[model samples]
Target: MPKVIFHKHGQVFEDEVKPETNLVVRAGIKQFPYPNLRYECGMGKCSKCACKVLAGAEHLPPPNWKEKKQLGERIDQGFRLACQIWLTHDIELCQEEITA
Candidate 1:
């Protein structure tokens, strides 16, 4: 299992998830990060699930086409589309809250 540390709105959420887990998919199923990990479309089209990788980035594979197209230069800043990443190692992420 991989440990996920999610930060948002100055709050932190930690959980252990199975390998090859997609945060967006887990959230959609009302899992640990649900109601906290803000997301819309499960696909990579929506950048709503974009988050900054604060740790364990080396364990993640290079961003896929969807992430590259959606995140662009932001990828260099460690921002990744949560929907595009499947976790296999511990990861720390921070998501900026969207204000209406």
Candidate 2:
């Protein structure tokens, strides 16, 4: 299993997850003990799942067409939709760091 680290509200939450786990699911599972994560849609439609790749961006799956379109102009800044990100390796993510 890989690990995901979420930084938000000036705090951090980490969780172990399978390789295929998306950010939305992992955030929800680990969010109970954290105050920063805000997950709205498990699917990729909502922008609430937006996060920044503080580190290990290469470990995540490449953005698909849907994610690219959803992220739109924000994609250039490393903003990724949580529901669209499938973890292939260890990663560190932060919502506040990326979201405008």
Candidate 3:
């Protein structure tokens, strides 16, 4: 069980994320910010799921080809495809820092 903290609207939401959880899906379920805007394409086509990795990158799976292609060189930065992430440790998300 890993904790996922979401900082949004001047409020902090902390929850434990189960294995194989999709960030976008979880955000949508938790209604973080504008869930609709956060999760547009279930597939990797849409960049809606993209977000800045505040922490836990070491605990997250490496970006797949799709994510790499979508993120381009930004992948080298903190940007990551939230929908493709499978939590291995605690992670934090912030709407203000979202890249896509």
Global lDDT for candidate 3?
A: 0.71
Scored against the true structure, residue 70 in model 1 reaches a CA lDDT of: 92
User: Using Cα atoms with residue i matched to residue i, what is each candidate's TM-score against the true structure?
Assistant: 0.95, 0.78, 0.76
lDDT of each: 0.94, 0.74, 0.71
Using TM-score as the measure, which candidate wins? 1
Model 1 Cα lDDT, one tens digit per residue, 14-52: 999999999999999999799899889989998999999
Q: What lDDT does candidate 1 reach at residue 33?
A: 93
Q: Write the per-residue lDDT of candidate 2 for residues 1-100, one digit (tens) a residue.
A: 8777788878788877777776667457764323466778767777777888888887766787877878887777888887777777888887774435
Better of 1 and 2 by TM-score: 1
What does candidate 3's lDDT look like per residue over 3-43, in tens digits?
88876666777778676677777656665334433567757
Q: Mind sharing the TM-score for model 3?
A: 0.76
Score candidate 1 by lDDT: 0.94
**Top-down lDDT ranking:** 1, 2, 3
- Stretches off by above 4 angstroms in model 1 are none
